[model samples]
Target: MEKFAMKKTLIALAALAATTAFAQSTATISGSINVGIMNTGASGAQTEVASLGGGANAININVAEDLGGGLRGGFDSQIRFNAANGDRNSAGAVNALFHTANTYLTGGFGTARIGSIVEAGTCAFDPWGCTGGAALQAGTGISALGGAASVKQAVQYTTPTVNGFSANYTSSLSARTNERQTLGVNYANGPLALTAINIKGSGNSTTDGGTAITDTATSQRAIGASYDFGVARLSFLNTVNKGVGGATTADFTSIGATVPMGAYTLLAGFNKNDRATANFDTKISVGVNYALSKRTTLGADLFRSEELAAIAPRTGTAGSGFVTRIRHTF
Candidate 1:
């Protein structure tokens, strides 16, 4: 009788342990789909079906596990696609099964991330959430890892927030001769948020036949701030790019505002790029969105640009355009 009781107790303890382990780990899948129609001022193709408002049609898979002792580990993977043609999103810019696959660990020591991690502060000030026709001109687009939004074989570390302030650093594991590095600091409290970042591109130099071969590198610095005033939220971003000799290559300034009125919200923005060659590119965008439910929205936008850079070669020149879209998340 004593032996049987001990055996039963052991089995009960084992079952409890298994249940606790399962509860401590989780895997979830979620994503959004955006589809819309667009008409632009481009010469030949002026009207088309595409994801409106620069929103993503993507699927996200996340897996996380508690490591105990104030530590946790996780992996996040995202796959983005074009809703119109069913092609991979940004195929020209990146060709891969997953747009991004990041592995990270978080704890009181802050967070450390690796793999094809997204660049920090890429489009924080973009009211369009950094994806589509509503994106700001590329001249001021901030990317810490080269010109793309994400870089492979990179690592990042962020310090724990203290008094609404924290710092972060990221660098690619590419060859040291031609590497990319980014450093940033952030502050957020109540209705105010601020960020500053510097991205540097390292050039290569070598001695060949007693001649000093040099490649000029460039660096970009940007500052962004936003404040929420209940009825309206306002944002501003300023960016400066410099060449090897500290010569200003370009300067970009943008201002944006969003107003909420119940289920309908209005957005507006203006951007200007000043090139060193005495040339300027400017753009203006205005849009509104109506929330049909917690997971669905309807939106429309009208925008015009003078020499606006192409968001993608396949999308062609945005120029002046209008778009209407339906977005749903699950």
Candidate 2:
């Protein structure tokens, strides 16, 4: 079943590509290579080797066409490779098959995308929307929890801008038999922007034996905004998730800032997560980047996280780490 699904997705992407090429008769290829090394200095920490002696890399290709009536369609894909072991980051093969990550159509009404990609909630709440760059939390964060990356079968739609405001909706259809939906509204004017998203998931709860036990429902609300002030930009994000029965509820909040000076930029951020059990965690990070040229940069980052639990003081420990990386665009 999974193979068939993948095949169908590929066919759709191929059709989209063909249409784009025929309509515009133009093609352009571009991507980036990022290499980084991470190191840790804490008690009992292992002296793991640092550097691109072993690293990961990503490549992407995009094709689009301009249609009449101000409409356009495109196909996008990406592949991640483990330069150390010469293996692909995805499942199945050494060099994973090129998967259509973003195949969509756009017009004056906005855009709609398909394939394995982020739901609308993340797009609305993330500081970086569809712009693929190091500024994205998923691309630069040291901890997975700091970035929410989920791939599911989804359909999304955005509305045309009205007075600098627009709305979006996304629905997920998966065999897990769960249905997830998200709605968001965005406003952008001058150097200020704001977005809010509400998400809900519903399905049948299963027991250990896989038997349906009860109806399960989950909901989340997130809001994020940023303001640019000439030399700096400040951003904040807040989210709350609610679950019933034996499920857990969670709340998260984050604040960050970026300042640019000449060819160098500074970034700092703080985030907190609280669970239903009252256990919480906090993370703080600071990073700096120096532009090597128009299309290249070198950066250094440091991050630390601490657990805060009343009953498990011993389980709570602080971790600090750093990474040095180089990014190049072609």
Best by lDDT: 1
Q: What lDDT is reached at residue 140 by model 2?
A: 26
| Candidate 2 lDDT by residue in tens digits, 36-79 | 66655343555332323111245667787777577888886766
Model 1 agreement with the true structure over 175-220: per-residue lDDT tens digits: 5564567788889999999988887765222122011112247677
lDDT of each: 0.69, 0.58
Residue 268 in candidate 2, Cα distance off native in Å: 0.8
Candidate 1: clashing pairs of residues = 54-132
Model 1 Cα displacement at 65 (Å)?
0.4
Task: Mark the regions of model 2 whose C-alpha exceeds 4 Å error after superposition.
Answer: 1-22, 40-57, 82-86, 90-102, 121-150, 202-217, 244-248, 276-280, 307-314
Q: How close is candidate 2 to the true structure, as a TM-score?
A: 0.71
**Residue pairs with clashing backbones, model 2:** none
